[model samples]
Target: MRSVSIKELLTGKQLLQEITVNGWVRTFRSNRFIALNDGSTLHNIQCVVDFEKFDDAILKHVNTGAALKITGTLVESQGKGQSVEIQVRDIFVHGGADPEVYPIQPKKHSLEFLREKAHLRVRTNTFSAVMRVRSALAFAIHQYFRDNGFYYFHAPIITGSDAEGAGEMFRVTTLDEKNPPLKEDGTVDFKEDFFGKETNLTVSGQLEAEAYAMALGKVYTFGPTFRAENSNTSRHLAEFWMIEPEMAFYDLDANMDLAEDFIKYVIRYVLDHCEEDLKFLETRLLDEEKTKPQAERSEMALIEKLKFITDNNFKRVTYTEAIEILRNSSPNKKKKFQYLIDEWGADLQSEHERYLVEKHFKCPVILFDYPAKIKAFYMRLNEDGKTVRAMDILFPGIGEIVGGSQREERLDVLKQKMAALDIPEEELWWYLDLRKFGTAVHSGFGLGFERLVLFATGMGNIRDVIPFPRTPQNAEF
Candidate 1:
């Protein structure tokens, strides 16, 4: 009477039962057999329909990629290959798709070719599994925060200042581009704009989330952020989601605890809830080196890792120690890095981060107290005078999955740092007022949501995990 999903049916041992299924035909073999998928999982259910029982007109309309509603009696497959098969009795064609026009067919298609038809890419098994895993991870994030007694704050998408203090931001406005407002000195008059000043898409929600945390004690913001940088790398995205959690009266150790626990919670949740999808990924989607047998790579392994992180302690190392390790490493000589790591002041690149996490620690590593010059001005300055209170969480596959820091609570120190960095004083007046009135020690971190999804799904590129990814030189679908 009711429709059943292929995913649910595959897990059960019942056979020779009546069932109804509705989905687009993935592939058709001869005139009597068809493969149907409802985008629930990678595996499609095979339906055997007798051509002689159906009208010739109905047979002609039942083409590959056409939407169908079929009522059938499920029977255990006599052959040793499949577990079960459906013997169709009635077929209803909801929509017909021409075989010559459908982008996806039974044959395999390259990831590059699929990217071109991103709107229709979800129909594929790999993309479908990826989307399901991505959804599960997002739910896990919310569940973790809610269960941990953290208030979810919706940070503004358009802001007056870059939270990261990085100069990469997309302008958001209704002002005419052609006849723009100009000042006496030929500078664009931002006063005439919508916000009465230069406004851009927020790069991070940590700063705003801190405002709420200071009042509410703990808060997190999960929303889409924009970056207008032209770097065309597998890691960078023009538009991506950021998960920022800010906590008041929290030190560096407490912040690290939240980071480690949150990450583990998300990974464990996805693996537990999306078991079928994870099995598909492990066997089919991931690279051969990373793939493992479903039984060997038990969901408990993921759960155990998460429990270990939550119960045990994490490995913590200072920036100075990280640089020392990099300087003495052999990869430094072989690989030509974008930024050289000769001394303690150099910014750590992806290669250095990866080396520290994968080769040196062999686990998730938290590197803190970065040099002041390389980090944001808002970070609390350490007693060393050369380094600031910043932390980056690096994983085995993805380099820097999370970036966060303790805020500069002192008004005087913040003002001095802003002056030295040539940041506009008026723009940060509201932020400064927060410190002047009553500012407690606050800390927060920004987790790249897509990067986390990439780590969870074992998807190599950042684009593959996100639906309709917006990257430099590419914005298909």
Candidate 2:
């Protein structure tokens, strides 16, 4: 007999064949049937054991959370939920999880309790399904880029320059903590540090990706990005994954088109491949929403929300138009908006983005032409002078799912912008060199990988979607 995966044995065409399988026991009922799962599928295989034939010692060891290797003949199940099961011929205990001490019992536990047990949470159905969908989404991302003529570029995790221009970063150093090098001005001298200068975890891979995009025509970086922002909200993470794709010779319009198409394609891929997992998450979300107020409940279920992305075209609206809509809308007029939009040039918040997507547009909305002062220094200056060619794709719950802009390729203009922002030219000399040598119309966007996984899994907390969440005062796992 050959060892077979539970996933295959559940759906495969090998009936009545004796097979060997290794898995953890999910549940043992009536001292005769064993629920076995090998992390291969969400569903468990019911191994019907002949209690009379089995030794009492072996039967006593078959308990929930125990790791077992079983030789069984695959046969059609008489159970309602599953189509197939295993008729156990033999059982061997590889490991045994004590029922009294094993934390993960076969029951519905709160996400909070599960998060505390992050190390062993995957044994649960919810997290396993989420992780499975996450894996599929990641694979789909690479596949999409590869099929679209994009090269994968790995950006350095430790960077000398702050790409986001936000000073928050986890300083990387190998200097003495109490007494080491000190500048004459009473500041810690970074000049004598490991890198011979100050360095921190990268906030983004876009700048490096831009360099490769100028040469390779299209490139993408999917890696962990760090931020030291002290946010304890459900959406914030100190460390998270980012998918930033840069394309040379692509204007803002083309960038938006690519983003919409790419998001839809990946979502559709997951919907097609992870039907069982997605269905479970959908039911989970429905149960979760049942406790919330009617007004606050989700208008669509989990899979319905995923289908919403693939079935409908994203609505494109300018920042100016979005501002006008928000200003005239009931939320602003009734003073319901926490941050009122009374004037132009005000940075739009999550509420504003959601209003436009969920309330105003009732679909995904692409908002473009943001004010220059509110955007980054690299975005191309529009002809109107007050705006840059920046665009943000907003989803129903996620305020900004994607942010991109046509980069300012003009060497003189880029230098002027850098000078105004007080960003040292030497710090990014290589970046400036791109503009000098072969700069072209290029654009890219950074999509938080956790955010995508969260949205796809209908998960409310960003921490739950990511395997090991790095947050303020929390890095236990």
Candidate 3:
């Protein structure tokens, strides 16, 4: 006799032998067949019980969602879709769920309904598969970084300087809210605060990661970052994870190559390692697509889409070139796009991005040399004076999958740019010191972890991929 997981038991290694297993009853239909699952696999093990031998009291407890310990003899199953079954010798009820109250029935539930039951949604097949895929993708990301000689560098969650932009961070304060300290200027006195200055949850770890990358040669950050943007969209989250890798000597072109290789590696990893879960998701996505009109459905299946990205080379185009392509494209000329690309400096919307990646290029597109005013101050300014060496990677459905640039290494140019933006020098004096001492060409990009997950899993909403999503209006979990 041995205790084994349902996954291992189904391998037929314990066939004709007595074994012990622990799991929750997914369904106890007819009181003769108990669908047992331990979260070890998407498939459940069928436990055939002799209802005549067990008392009704014990059988009554074997409801769906009830945790059970079963001692049974593994034998060949005569049922379809299953190879083996358990002949229960004994049963123990560890916990029980009242059928009336248990929300996760063996039926289809809307994604909106599942969000309300976040704690128990993992018991369902779809969420369990989603979570399993999420875990695999996370492991794949770290594996890719480690294999590429990138060290994991952790940045502080509470930071004094805003990396992306100001006014988009959640304030971190321990001071009194009703009657707080005020200065003569009638402003809240952060000088007496816990950190003795203004602090907020970090919106990006790029700045801190750059400091470490300068020393580590290559460094990456994978952690929770907070953004206070009040966007209630499927693509935005109040709290999300970011994957940013900063390289010490890499230029913009090298940065683009790394981004492409890194994403393709992770996606390939998921395709191989999470095949079972991905197949399930692929079928789920196909079903979801069927509800839409023929014109609105996806061009390829879920798994096919993943392979398409890995097999194809990303089309590299300049920002000005992309603008000209979009400006003269049929969509723009016919007024099909919501935001028409009228000029070079115009910000491209999702419609324009999809057109370039999906319709025009038919592959991932890396658009570089963006307008300097639209990009961050840290991005390297091109010789053209009007544009910076900023690049954005756009996938077919996902407009912006990655954003990176060769950083401004020139101390004088960086100061001029900062001064032009009214950013005080003292706010980032240490950052300036890197250039003063021994700064060289360095570049990095940030990949929104949830967005990657959403794409890999063929999920529509950003919240569905994350376990407990933190949105502008919801954080109940």
Candidate 4:
């Protein structure tokens, strides 16, 4: 008998075939039935085992968290609820899990409680479904870029300069924390560090990915990026994965197209392949009534929205226009924003972005040409001399999922921008050299991988979608 995937069993027509499955028991109901998941799919395989045939001693050891190998005959379920089931004939206990100590039980547990047992949370139905959706979305990301002729580039983790220029970085050093080297000016001597410079974890891979794109014509980097930001919100994470795609001979419009298409592709793939898991998440994770038909809830709405994005074109709006709309729509002059975006030059807050995408646009909106003073130095300055060629893709539920812009290809303009921003020119010599030698018009964007996972699974928090979330003040497991 060959092993069959749970998804295959659910979708396939053949029944009464002998199969073998190896997995940890999610739950043992009534001491005669078991719910098994092999991590193959989000849906668990329900097995009906007769304790009379098996030894009572052996059955006693098969607890909730035990690993087991079951040889069973698959049969079309005649039960009123389930579609398929397996009748077990032989059972082998591979590992035993004590019921008293296992963190995950058959009953309901809070998300905060599950976060504490991050190591074992995947055994639960919600986490299992989330992980499956996460895996599918990640695969879709790679497929989208690869199909479009994008070369995947691996960027360095430990870097000399902060790529985001945000000054939030976790220093990488070998010096003793208690007795650090001192300079003549009575400051810490960064030159004596392990890297012999002020090295920190990479905040973004865009700078390095740009170099490869300029050489290779089209390149993308997908890897872990670290941020030392202290604000612990549901959306923020200390360590997360980012997908950055850089294209040569491309501008802001082309970049937005790629971002939109990439998001649509991933969403479509996950919805198509992980239907069972999506259903599980829709029922359990989102807290929607399980009695309602699976298609009735907002998951269908999300699917419809994604299909709309995939089939139709995205709406483009300038930042100035968006600000004007916001100002006109609100009667109160001093309306309190979460991040306080009161003026035109200030950065857009999540509240403002959500309002525009959710209420005004009613679809994914690509807002471009933001104030240059608020954006990074690499973005190309527009003709107005005030706004830069930066764009942010905001979705209804998730705001600013993708951030990218056209690079300042001209050497003199880039140098001037860097000088105006007060960034050290010596540190970016190699980056500037690309422009001096043979830099063509190029653009790229960084898509937060966890955010994409959150969007795909409809998972609310950023911590739930990631396997081992590294958030501020939380690195357990």
Q: Stretches of candidate 2 above 4 Å error? A: none
Worst 10 residues of 4 by lDDT: 295-304
lDDT of each: 0.83, 0.92, 0.92, 0.84
Candidate 1 lDDT tens digits, 73-113 = 88886555568888999999999888779778878787778
Q: What are the candidates' C-alpha RMSDs?
A: 3.9, 1.1, 1.1, 3.2
Error of 1 at 69 (Å): 1.3
Model 3 residue 323 lDDT score: 92
Name the regions of candidate 3 deviating beyond 4 angstroms: none
Q: Cα deviation of 72 in candidate 1 (Å)?
A: 1.9
- Quality of model 3 by C-alpha lDDT: 0.92
| lDDT of candidate 4 over 261-292, digit per residue (tens) | 78888888987888877776655644643545
- Per-residue CA lDDT of model 2 for 1-477, tens digit only, reads 667889998885889888999999999999888999988889898899989999998887788889999998889988887788889888999988889888999998899999999998898999999999999999999999999999999999999999989899999999999997998989999999999999999999999999999989999999999999999999999999999999999999999999999999999999999999999999989989899999888888888888889999999999999888999999999999999999988999999998998888899999999999998988999889889999999988778888889989998988988999999899999999999897789999989999999999999999999888999999997
Clashes of each: 0, 0, 0, 0
Candidate 3 colliding pairs = none
- What would the TM-scores of all predictions be? 0.92, 0.98, 0.98, 0.93
**Which is the better candidate, 1 or 2, if ranked by TM-score?**
2
